[model samples]
Target: MSMTPPPGWYRDPSYPLVERWWDGTAWTDHRRQPEAPQLPLTQPESPGGGGSGRAKAVALSVAGVVLVASIVTGAVLLRRDDGSGDAAATTTETTTETTTATTAVSPSASDTPSPSASTSAPSPDDPSVVVDELNGITLPLLDGWVRPQYVAEHDIVMTTPGTYDCPGDPGLCRHGRVISRTVTANDEKSPKALAQQDIEDAANSSYDRDLIDNRPFKGITSHQEVKSGQVAVAGRAGYFVRWKVKTRVGPGGYVESLAFPSSVGSESLVIVRFAFDAGSDGPPLTDMDRITKGIRPVGDADTGGGVGSSIGPSK
Candidate 1:
């Protein structure tokens, strides 16, 4: 006969990075990062006591085995005296108790999400809000904006629904877009320096060309600074740089790069990029300020109070 493993967390067969929980009968949705294995510590024997210690250990092992066997035999005899059906019921009850105790005492019990939490967890695709869990921030879903169905790796994006043909390429493009992601591959931590440096790239990507060198706005010919200054975002001091770029085809667009320390998770630097079509069809310029003001820490309710402010050009 086969025996089922007790309810516990075990290495996930599909995902090596995390462990999955088995609830006696089946795997649960619960998973967590694997913890480092701990090595057992051994107590060293005193000088000139190795032989005596070994002898005592052997004796103790033998005694433990004998004690266990005696207990097993007594249990079997008692069960035999009880009806077989009663014995089976008792075994089932004992197994259930063991499973509960094991789960309650698990080292990862504190880390596991409760059933309520699992059900109530926020989604990135929330219609009225974009939850960027990776950066621990939330952006408001203003009118005409929706979460992107597919975002680039490491990016959380919200864009205007529907698309229009690119001026220079056969690909489609949106009138407005915003992307949030943690800053990486750079050592600079100053918000102003990072924002200023990233704005050019942001403008280039939004107006000049895409990853495949597709010039969505037919390539930016020149850009004029619209705003570059210190700002407060999600209650954190940050910086932003915005520019209006002239393109060879279609109406040129406005782009901005904002940098700040994330409100959560080691306070890593985060960058938010914005691109909007530069015409009556695009989102209003004031909406940029409204969206910036609407940003808040994850789980924070929209108090409707403007928390972000542009303090003018950085010295």
Candidate 2:
């Protein structure tokens, strides 16, 4: 029986130090340095059997040999503790060669996409307003912000200049600036678990820093009454995080994310994020708050307002 990990990037169990893509079915050629930008899946055509089966076979074979070699090397070291140093050295060399040969056939982590490879310059066809069809919400034109027509190799949309243009780190770019697809939760999952998974996915790709350094604010809710200048997510209660990441431009790289359950205890999730350069004159937290607060399901309205409606902002 095959036990594949759920769809996401995880530390390659076989490779140990590197991360590999698990497209919910099998490992893919896509890999990266831990906490780096996640590369898109590049699956090659197989001769007859399935690609996943072949990958698993190769990985298992390599793992078995490596394990056996490690045991043998350990035993040799124990027995040679009081013996000649020359014998110990020879045994070590042989074991090292065996391990190297076993791993040489696998894909190199360097083949992963670069940060530059994952970004693109804005183009024409960008509309005056940004609409998220999935969530039935729309964003009117904000000054100095352009809707990206093409964000190469990433699922995230860049709503602002600093959102995905990390000269220092490229793999963390997000291009699908308007909306994200709905993430349906399984029966066993909770809303918080779903939110944490979203964060983990980001951390897995281009988020290699400590959570403490990110300075994430905890216990966020999606209440419309929270405050005037904070994120007001629609639907159910949600999770919020503010990341103060360092980039080449300055230490002003900021990422604010809002995630909420589509409804009370429902298995559906709705998440929104805002990335910007906060060096000195970065976008205010109120703006970030307004952006999220303005999101609402189509035809969904609050007592006083709705998304892109009469209450949030005057257009």
Candidate 3:
């Protein structure tokens, strides 16, 4: 007759490192690391020394044999429970192992990443786009244009790469340039009035004198209105004024001031200034219209339009 062990935790037959719970006759899902087995302390030898020691030794040996027998009986019972042959036994073992692995905590899952952590806004320095965070707008970069490395008072500026000696000054100058900024100083609210007021200053700055008091275009001898009208810019109603200015030296240039209500913060008025050389080397006059149309809300998709040929660095 086989002896059945009482319900308790015992060292697992297959997994030596862990203990599994046995419920009188069968193993349970509960498992834990095996606790160290404790040995009873030996009593001090009495006057009958060797005999007492020998009896104690025999008792311990018998107890150890009983433990081994109980484990062997449990193993046999487990196999009989399966009823099938070696294949069923193997499947049982595999399932137990898989359950153990599934319950274990994985190191990687401890630190979960946030969904928004991987997202980021478009860079303002991107070669093909110019982001103006202040006024919440973006200007498309044309083939012959680039974001200026140094921007003075403008919120955003783009210009032809490289520069040439000014006709009337010792300073360097670009043939094509565009700048955008909010109109904070002026109290003018009407787009038409703002555009009309800014055009003369735009021409004077482009053809009269630069920041350093250098006259790149010598001086504006005269200027004639080439285009003036209400226009739509970046989905906003706006107005623009273009002028053909004659300079004291070189083939002069065209200047334009476009004023529009910004789509962002406070809906502030914004002014975009444009200056382009009049000769064949300058950016196309049509590019002015293209750029104005290309302006969009900061996050809008880019609308492609610009000069196809890149302007090389001045020799």
Off by over 4 Å in 2: 1-129, 153-158, 161-166, 169-179, 185-189, 203-232, 247-252, 263-267, 301-315
Question: How much RMSD separates candidate 2 from the native structure?
Answer: 17.2
State the displacement of the C-alpha of residue 170, model 2, in Å, after optimal TM-score superposition: 7.7
Model 2 scores a TM of 0.40
TM-score versus the correct structure, for each prediction: 0.57, 0.40, 0.55
Mind giving the per-residue lDDT tens digits that candidate 1 earns over 12-60? Answer: 4344344444444443433334444422222234456553332222222
Pairs with steric clashes in candidate 2: 36-206, 115-170, 156-174, 156-175, 156-176, 157-175, 157-176, 157-177, 230-289
Q: How do the residues 1-315 of candidate 2 rate in per-residue lDDT, one tens digit apiece?
A: 344334554445556454544444434433334554433333343555455544544444312112232244335434422212112121001000001011323434542332221223322464444545444444444665654422321323334443332233222332213234345433323434544444423322222221111211111111111222222355444555545443323333344445554532343556554544344545555565556655554345451222233322111
Clashes of each: 0, 9, 0
Cα-based lDDT for every prediction: 0.56, 0.36, 0.57
Worst 10 residues of 2 by lDDT: 91-100
Query: Candidate 3: misplaced stretches above 4 Å?
Result: 1-127, 150-156, 302-315
